[model samples]
Target: MIDIRLGGARPESAQGCVAVPVPAADGGAPVAITPGLLPDDVAAEAAAYLAETEHKGAAGSVQSLPRPLRQPSKLLLVGVGAGDEAGWRTAGAALARAAVREAELTVLAPAELTDAALRGLAEGLWLASYRFAMIEPKADAAPKLAQVTVAVAATPEREAALAAARTVSDLTRFARDLTNTPSQLKTPAWFVEQVLARTGARVTATVRDQDQLAAEGFGGILAVGGGSAQPPRLLQLSWAPEGATRHVVLVGKGITFDTGGIDIKPTEAMQLMRKDMGAAATVCATILAAAELDLPVRVTVLAPLAENMVSGSSWRSGDVVTHYGGLTSEVHSTDAEGRVVLADAMAYAVARLEPDLLLDLATLTGASRVALGKKTAAVFSDNEELVAGIGTAAAQAGELVWRLPLADEYVKDVAAEIADLNNAAGNPGAITAALYLREFAGPLRDRWLHVDMSAPSWSGGTDGELVKGATGWGVRTLVRWLQGLAA
Candidate 1:
């Protein structure tokens, strides 16, 4: 993790050269650090790098100035593409990673930093700062980032900009911690307990255990998780809006760990199974954000959590399972457990909570990764307005979200031979999973959006702003979307 601080030297106090290093796009040049250049060096070198190299502020390019001359020793000037906020943020992340080798570093922002740019920079740093060292005994050898100096040219606005960046950093860290937890320690029960312990008067968390679920007819959760030793749970968290009529429902698939049940997953595929609860973590984090921001809109989050394990009691193929909303589903494949849990949670949220808009997220399908890849999150929904809102939110949050079609024609694959629907669809796995969830959502169909976050839920590579574990993909998107609605 990087420690951030304000620069001690104001523009008037500058006495030494600051290295304005340019990160070569193709690794063509060893990082060039111009010593003793100061702020003027940063400006001059940035222009020269941009004009000479025409760096598009592309993912690999340098984005910001690392103040090497300052007491911190190294100032990195990273080139964010074309002066855009996202570009600068991407650059900020690149610089953070490059500076990991340094004992500590400070980043100097341009004199006039917009709120958007500041926010992006903070988020990028947080994203890039995450390190998953739990499995590696030597992981602790990696030096911690001691400080980041968001040095804006000394002015009244400096304080505000720095303050804003700090706020964003705090929120980004909050989201990151939720996403980084391992499944073994972050089960549904544990998550609920944590929420109960964390939430104050403004938020409420309710967890329904196996016995309560059985009595309440939430069969979808029971049938899907029945095979595992860990019992199923439904965590409902809510906050009342102040003088607001609009309400939003957020649902997450909280499979604490997915072992593919009777249809076991391969060893490689099961390695990151702990991140299967990413959806749940995201929803929980978003709810906390909403409460923290005091959004004037009623919000309800439903996280249906369970461990998908193989056992004698596991639901088998061809078995008809009844859900909470009185819908019968045929269990064709036990591995398609995410949608099963989400189906019950979505229904409960829409019917019981009665939110005006619904959005649900899950690492539910491999097909989503195939469609959207690792950087972009796949979004499916019938409502264009909601989709637009989501798109805007993702843009603001500096996250990637691509809208995918939820074609009505594809809904047939979920139709079962003997039941109302099939838990596992025959084609378009990701889309079909969302389609399966739609059945239990009832009449609020147009207000719904489903995010298939299969790719971004966990990382195989430690790229810029992405750690090698759970990414906490949906937290920022959900928080931004809800905040936008509130505004």
Candidate 2:
């Protein structure tokens, strides 16, 4: 991890490059930076290098003073791109990648940086520096980047921005750690133990054991985890302070490791199945951030935790699983177990809490991944207000999301032969899956949105704040949305 701190003055000597923020090019060569940002000889060479190179100061563009190296002794100017929050974050990720082999960097503050922009930069640095090293490498192996110091005037705003970024980004890393853990260690019961230990007193985490689940009739959760030695669990983490009104409930599908149950996936497909619980990881981080930030809005997270493994006891494709509140779903494909368990949590949230707003998140469909690719989240709902609000918040949080239709036309495709709903809907799979979850929404259907984040939930590479696995994709957006509700 990189230690990000505020500094008053520039250091005379540094192990790595000193990066200064430069805005995007308006016209001719990118906006020029002062020679004060670099050594005279190196600055002169960089000037000549810039004239020969195509460094336009666009976001993620970096111009090393003398020459670019895997680990730079100096990189003079990094593009801040209009100096917005996203720009700062992009710059931080770019710089971190460029200087990974070096010791530290001292960055000069932009001329006028907002609190939001500062937070973005700090978060980018912290998140990009994250490495999930469960195993210790050789002593001579590449060392982690140590520190980042931003040369800026200290103020309450600066302190608040840095503190907020640390809280959110650290929790995001926490979620990443959870997602990156091997499936052998992250069983449903073990996941519940993590929730209890991690959340502690900051957020009230309650767990309903297997017996409680059976008593409460969470047939979907039980059936999904039946093959595993570790049983299913219903975990609720709440952040309710005094006098808070608007109640928001989020249900996350927490399938620890999905081997696709009786309808098992292809051999190569199960390799990344350990990340199937990404929705639960993200939701846990989001609510924890809310509690830490002391957001004055009542919010609760309902995670139906299970592991869909293959065994004699595994749920079959033709089986009917009754969810919480007695909503029966016919399992057309055991691979579609995510929505089956997610329905139970959403129904429980509605029947018990009666929240003012609801949203369910899961790595549900491959069709969504095909439609939106791996970097963007796909959302579906009939609730116009809910969609709009989430759009605004996602944009502000620098998380990309595309709204897919939640048209009722797909409802017919998901109607079951004998049960209340069918778990699998053929093509245009993303929309049909959303319609299926909406079956249990009841009154909340019109006020809810279902996020099929199959693609963004786990990343193939470490780009930006996201690491290579378990992106913790929705934490920032949900926290930002909750911040808006409090405001």
Candidate 3:
């Protein structure tokens, strides 16, 4: 993790590269800088550079100049086009990427940056600076922006906001590590131990093995895990703080590796299947974040772990699996195993926990990816208010989520001829998948929100706060939403 702190020495006295925020001038006026932030000589030097380069102070733009002072080697003018939170965030990310070779950075914030904008700046820097190189690389190959210090007048509110931003970034990165782990080391049993290690003492951890799940009738998990040498597991982690009035139960699909069972996916498609467990990583990190932040809300997480592989024992497409609580689902496509396992977890959550909100996230459908593209996720539910609230939370958390209609008319499409429901219903797949999960929600349907994060969970390339692998998409949004309940 990068070392970050708030309210260090003044910009002129900073130890490493000094970065100064420069707002774009109105109507092409002269360059403007905070009156007291920089010394007269260095400010004059920066003004000269901006004029020479014709810099307009566009958001996420940087211009470097030699510092007149002998101590600091360089001067950076980071742009905040509109000086808004979004602009600050972009500026922060851009600065981080630009300062990769520097050992330390001292960022001079805007004179009037609000708590919200400050949080955005800190979050952008931390998230963008994250690197997940698995191999042992040469010493010179590593980028070295190890320490960051923000130079500003510190207040309790500002310091608290910084700490909060750090917490979210650190936890989100933790989730990213889990999601990016190779399936060889990330089996169902390994995942459970990882959860137990991080789940603080305030939280309780329960592990149900294949035998327990079989006795308890968790057919969906067993059916999915039947093909792999690794058995299935159901992990329930809970953080129930005192005086908590709201309870939120989150369910996630934990397919550690998906060869798509007997019905295999294409070579290219199966390559990234290790990320099939993204939702489980996200929800686990989220509930643990709630414990770390010590929010006044009760949170429970249910993760159904499995690996859908190919073997003679693999569950076939025509098979009907009897799930927990005696509900039956026809496996129309073994590739649709995410929602199958998710159904068992959601049924367990709905039956055992009385939740103010019931939410489940999964990388369940490629159709969802087709509809929403790679950066945005598709959310489904009958609760309009809950969907709106989730959108708001995603916006605040710097994650992307869009609500897709439940389409009650499509409810009939999820029905199977022989069983109660079909795992893979026909076209408009994302909608029918949500509808299928709703069948298992059973009377808690009204409060349930299902997120199909098929595309957003894995990033194809780095963009701003996103890295190239497992994106840890939902942890930020879910954490912020749960924390808001405390208010």
Candidate 4:
């Protein structure tokens, strides 16, 4: 984690690389670039460099000065396109990348730094500075920037914003670390242990092994995890503060590694299956962040941990199993196993927890990625208010989520002749998978929201704050949404 601190004004005098924001090409108001923000000689030199290089201020664009007339070792002209929150975040990330070799860095906050903007800048810096060196060989070279200072006005609101930013950044990185770990090292038991270790007094975590799962009738989880030598487990993390007004139950599909069981995936497709538990990592991170922030809401997380692998005892296609609420489902494809485990967890949440609002996330389908691309998660819900609220939260957090119609008419696609539903449907697979989970939502279907996060959970390449691996996509959105409920 990067040590980020609030610094005094005049970032040019700060150590290491000093990042200064430049407005976009079509920027409306003229942001005063005076000596007060940057030294007069340095500002003139930057303007000359920009003119020489034809540097139009577009978001995520950078221009570095190796020999600058300033106290700082180097100067960075970071582009703030349109001066929006997203643009500010992009600028912050760009600055981080440019200053990757620097041991210390400072970002000069713009004159119009609102609480939201400050949070965005801080998030970008911390997120971009993330490095996952768990298994990789250590480099003899000096590490990346160990400390970052954001030069902003010292106010109570700004301090609160910075605190929130730190919470999200740290938890998101935590999720990324869990998701990127090798599947062999991160099994069902390991996930439970990690959760228990991170949770505080406000949160109580309980784990139920295979024996308990069978007794509780979680057939879906049991069947999918039957092939793995390590037994399946159901982890329930609850945070119910006294006098809490609303109950929000979250279910995450925790497939530590997916090999498609009896119906195996191709060799090329099986490479990144370790990240199949991205949803579990995300929800756990959100709950931990909520506990840290002390949000006044009753939150419960149901994570069904399993590994979908192939063996003599592997669950085969056409096998029928009864889920938690007695809903029987036929296994059409083992690759569609995420929704299977989630079904049991969701049904259990509805039957036992009786939440005011229920949301489940899973890397459930490849068709979702094919349909929504890799940057946006597909959302499905019958409740308009819930959809709108999540949309607002996503916008505030700069996460992309697109709401697809529930299309109840297509429920028959997953309907089976011998069972209540089949795990896999033909075309429009994402919607059908969501519909399959909807059946387990019971009478409170309108209160349930299912997010198909297969697409956004991992990034193929570096983009702004998102790195090239597990993106930790949903944590910030969930945190912001839960915070809104508390508000």
**What TM-score would every model get versus the actual structure?**
0.87, 0.94, 0.96, 0.96
lDDT of each: 0.73, 0.83, 0.87, 0.86
Cα misplacement distance, residue 64 of candidate 2 (Å): 2.5
The TM-score, computed over Cα atoms with residue i paired to residue i, of candidate 1 is: 0.87
Which lDDT tens digits does candidate 3 get at residues 1-487? 6677777887567655888887777887866777777777877777888888887888778998765557466878888777877777777888888898888989877557788888888888888887776797678978789888878778899988888888888888988888899999999999999889887689899999999999999999999999989999999999999999989999988999999888899999899999999999999999888988899999999999999999888999999999988899988999999989999998888887878889999998888888989889999888888898889889888788988888989988899999999999978999999899999889989999999998999888868778689888998899888877788
* C-alpha positional error of residue 427 in candidate 4 after TM-score superposition, expressed in Å: 1.0
| Residues 1-487 of candidate 4: C-alpha lDDT, one tens digit per residue | 7777776646446665788787765455433343456777877777888777667788788988877553766778888776778888888788778887888888877666788877888888888877775666456554577877778767888889889999999999999999998988999999888878889787998889999999989999999999999889999998888889999999988999999998898999999999999999999999999888889999999999999989988899989989998999988888889999999999998889989999999988888888889899999999999999899999988899999888878988989979999999877888888898899999889899999999899988789998889999899999999989988
| Residues 1-487, model 1: lDDT tens digits | 4665555555334433222323343454433333333546445555665566555434436543344535323334566544466766676677667766655454545555566676666667767876655566365666456666665544555555545445445555554565567767867677677667766788987889999999988888998789877788998899886797888888888888889988789999998788787888787777777787777888888989888888899888888888887889988898888888888888788778878988888888888788888888899888889889999988877678898878889888889999999998867888888888888778988888899888887777776667677677777777778778877
Steric clash count of candidate 4:
0
Regions of candidate 3 where Cα sits further than 4 Å from its true position: 24-31, 68-71
Better of 1 and 4 by lDDT: 4
* Candidate 2 lDDT by residue in tens digits, 39-154: 56655666666666766767768876644452335665788887899999988888787777767788877446688888888878887777776788776666556888887777
Q: After superposition, how far is residue 106 of candidate 4 from its true place, in Å?
A: 1.8
Query: What pairs collide in candidate 4?
Result: none
Model 3 TM: 0.96
Name the weakest run of 10 consecutive residues (lDDT summed) in model 2. 7-16
